[model samples]
Target: MAGSRKIELTEALALGSEWRHMCFAILYAPDPRMLFGRIPLRYAVLMEMRFDGRLGFPGGFVNSQKRTLEDGLNRELLTKLGEAASAFSVERTEYRNSHAEDTTHVVAHFYAKRLTLEQLEAVEAGAPKAKDHGLEVLGLVRVPLYTLRDGVGGLPAFLENSFIGAAREVLLEALRDLELVEPGSVLNFKRHSFRQPSLNS
Candidate 1:
């Protein structure tokens, strides 16, 4: 095979028939006004959904006919953002979850895109009010890297999703990579504490 890794999707009826395999972006943008201006950080986070009625990244599941997860995610982003795939950079792929009941798992491909203040303003000015999913995404919101520690508040509910946990990790990792947070000083918020269980469960 030309690629060293591959993904396969399957329906797990026993696990509420939820199909495995998905992708997400850890969208980031450098902001200089926050945290007393001591840290040059990026806005990595969730946006309020316009259709699904939740917050999430600009991504989706791989089409069965697609050869790669990146392809599917790129397509979804373009469809939603009206931009080209080259507009963003794939930072890293993080393993979010794996199913033991079946040979299926979910992976989030975290992407990083730098936007200027003017670009951000323009994006906000002309962004679509909603996506094909009918989700009225209230545009992208910066994940507060400073408030990511314990006892902090204002985290979006969708960030607590089990599927998006990897996205969170990617955010943390990116923060660390950017020297915004010290190594090994990141917080671990419990997913179950905030996330609702599957309806069928």
Candidate 2:
């Protein structure tokens, strides 16, 4: 289980205080639906299947003294995406959220970045040769953000997919913050998910 809330730090801890930590990159490209900005538009999120068979973004442990967060992100990308890392230009990376994981007791930091469609395609094309493929990573998947604009419901169904750690929650919060999906819809989806029986049920 993972904490449902964000990590709250009263005072900054020493650099080495954290025993376990991780970073994830949420990369997105403009959706095809954005044709001349005339149709409903949404960004497409890159997700992947972890070795544990759960879904999550790409990225890994941070070597704070050795590299910046973006550098760490790029390193992980290279590991999972191979030489495709050279194709993408990281527009900017924003802090997404933080979660204190229960299983490993690791603090996870998430960052969102925008990439050109061509770059994303390059990464996808190079995935088969990625060093971590089939070991640390099982395969790549995409979260369809275009459905988020649906009035009846779409975000919840997307969330229904099994996501590792606090990924689902992090995505929900991030999507809300990005204004890609309405908060009310997410709230409704939360309520809907809560009413359902757990998978173990």
Candidate 3:
């Protein structure tokens, strides 16, 4: 959090040779499927419930000395999404934002890619069998792209849950950037009623 500030992807890539790079992305599909025969599942975005009990996108560190950022990112995708990730790719053109954390000599890169519904499902189905499953990657979380009748559930509720670092920021930016959700709509969420979680839930 020291030397970190939002900068162009190219600028981040051009940093002096002292920085390490970590890349992550938001994988989403054009989902027209209906939920419970009523609610429309507009966009299916994948986020992981990390081992640390925080939510973040599916990806990991990329050693520039070993592989290109895109290649390293794909390698991580394969590890986290299992064989289903074979067909998915995140190109450099999809790069979104980059922030440099000078304190640790690390720079974070964010990406967003679109997949078909079928392809997305394959990733989801195969995630449980991925190499990092249940370890660094605890579970797959599909962002609820819609709001309930009272505007208090779905995305709003999902927002209430904890997110790690820039996960929440990237998610909101992607939602608006992709036109999956209208701009400024996320801020109008109604607060949810307080309820205790069940031990069995």
Candidate 4:
């Protein structure tokens, strides 16, 4: 069940009360800015550089026994981000999909929200001052939403970094489904096997 994908939010929330729930979000905005007057920056997708040196979205496990999933996610946002987190509106309708880590009896729910460039910038500016700064979250990392002329930079190059848990797949699918990255680009990741090279070779 670890490999299961695309479960609807309703189906996921309806599961037997034995499963644990974790939530994360892809906070993005239309970045109509450019660098050096060329190569439009396109969009700003926010992720976190965790204290563990792995990349992930800004959220954590929620106790469904108390708060609803979205409330739990926003609660995490308030801690990982500062007062700027209040600007986020992640309703149940924005729910993307769920992933089953049946081995651990945990299911992760993903969400995506589009914000104004100003609001997105606020989240970045306030992050360093958040309660979890340098503890659980090292800092905010923006996903490169562009491909360079050489065709290997931007998203492709960014993909080389390590992602936490199923965050990598969560990112690729979010980009493809949101029409931010071409389907081919997501397919090219090919399950992200990091094969070690032999010293003799």
Candidate 5:
């Protein structure tokens, strides 16, 4: 989905109870204040460059027969974050939203979790040993919160990066709901307008 220029969405289906469940998390930690650093001490979200080269949160299909959503999420966290999984508490996981996914008709369940700076460091430290690293995940990526918070009235560089399925919108929604970003900023981003060049030369 990332390599291609065209963006695609799953085909719409009738509202029904039957839907394949999937889950992902927008995990973040408060940025540590730096005396001198390019990336200021600000909150950041952990993301993954998936096998398909598309940016997305760390998670996978929910085996409803084997485990519940929470259980599945914990499993995914362990897989993606490795030993770093123990560094942070679950805090609270909310049912962010449910959206249909491409082709698979996957009903994606997204969650947002907060982590301590210590936990963030642990996650970074454990990245080299992440079980899914290089296999399902090409690499890790961080989306700085300041960019989104101040990225209104135009497309942010972060938004330019391709996201899997409905991840971009979902990420934005999570940020807005978490109070990390303003609703106006999100709204402005959605209504991004481009100026046309003058034809007369």
Candidate 6:
């Protein structure tokens, strides 16, 4: 019955409405050899539209008619990625709200899924053909732990803007569920400007 609450697009627009949020899993595979003694794991982030270009995860708003957040996300993934969605398993989720100081109350639900190396390969191979809402995703980025460190400076434009917090939270949850990352491995970074640092002499 809850899913039956149909908020028409026109009404939603009038109310400055918000839509459902979704994301795909960033999986890591352990590698036996690494110079820093850190686990060699494969990481993934979504390629979405931003001022700069495509970044972030594969997700979007939930259809009001769906029973759960997962239902909506799964539907969108399947629709956009086609058989690529079949390669991974969605393992966990988290829910939160937007921090914007506006009347439009927004709720976001993030999900994490794990895929085999072969599955990841399939996704990479299929990304060129995937399209959602007329946007063509560039595909997932395999981030290394050192990249999060190495004083590399910043995240991608879309990740910096949209799902930075959610990304850390969901990745931690996924790692914990899989017993991969340590309990505190997920570090929440403070919000910082993505603009290039000024070099005032």
**Candidate that scores best on TM-score:** 3
Model 1: lDDT equals 0.47
Residues 116-181, candidate 5: write the lDDT tens digits.
Answer: 777877887787698998899777777755442454312366676767877887777777777665
Candidate lDDT values, in order? 0.47, 0.69, 0.84, 0.84, 0.67, 0.46
CA shift at 178, candidate 5, in angstroms?
0.9
Clashes of each: 7, 0, 0, 0, 0, 6
lDDT of 3 by residue, 16-92 (tens): 88888888989999988798899988889999999988899988888888788999999999998899999878998
For residues 13-118, write the lDDT of model 6, one tens digit per residue: 3443354333343434543345357534434433444223434456565654444555676766765665677665454343222212133243344454555556
Q: Point out where model 3 deviates above 4 Å.
A: 1-4, 187-201
lDDT of 3: 0.84
lDDT of model 3 at position 138: 90
Q: Per-residue lDDT of 95-186 in model 4, one digit per residue for the tens?
A: 88888766677788889998898999999999999999999999998998777888777877788787777888888888888877655767
Of the pair 1 and 3, which is ahead by TM-score?
3
Model 5 misplaced stretches (Cα beyond 4 Å) = 1-18, 32-41, 89-93, 147-155, 193-201
For candidate 1, write residues 1-201 as lDDT tens digits: 111132223322123435444555544445556555564344533333435444456666655344465666666666555543345544325323222223344333445555555555444444554244234454555555554334444343434544333444455455566554445445444333555678797
Q: Score every model by TM-score.
A: 0.54, 0.78, 0.88, 0.87, 0.75, 0.55
Name the candidate, 3 or 6, with the larger TM-score value. Answer: 3
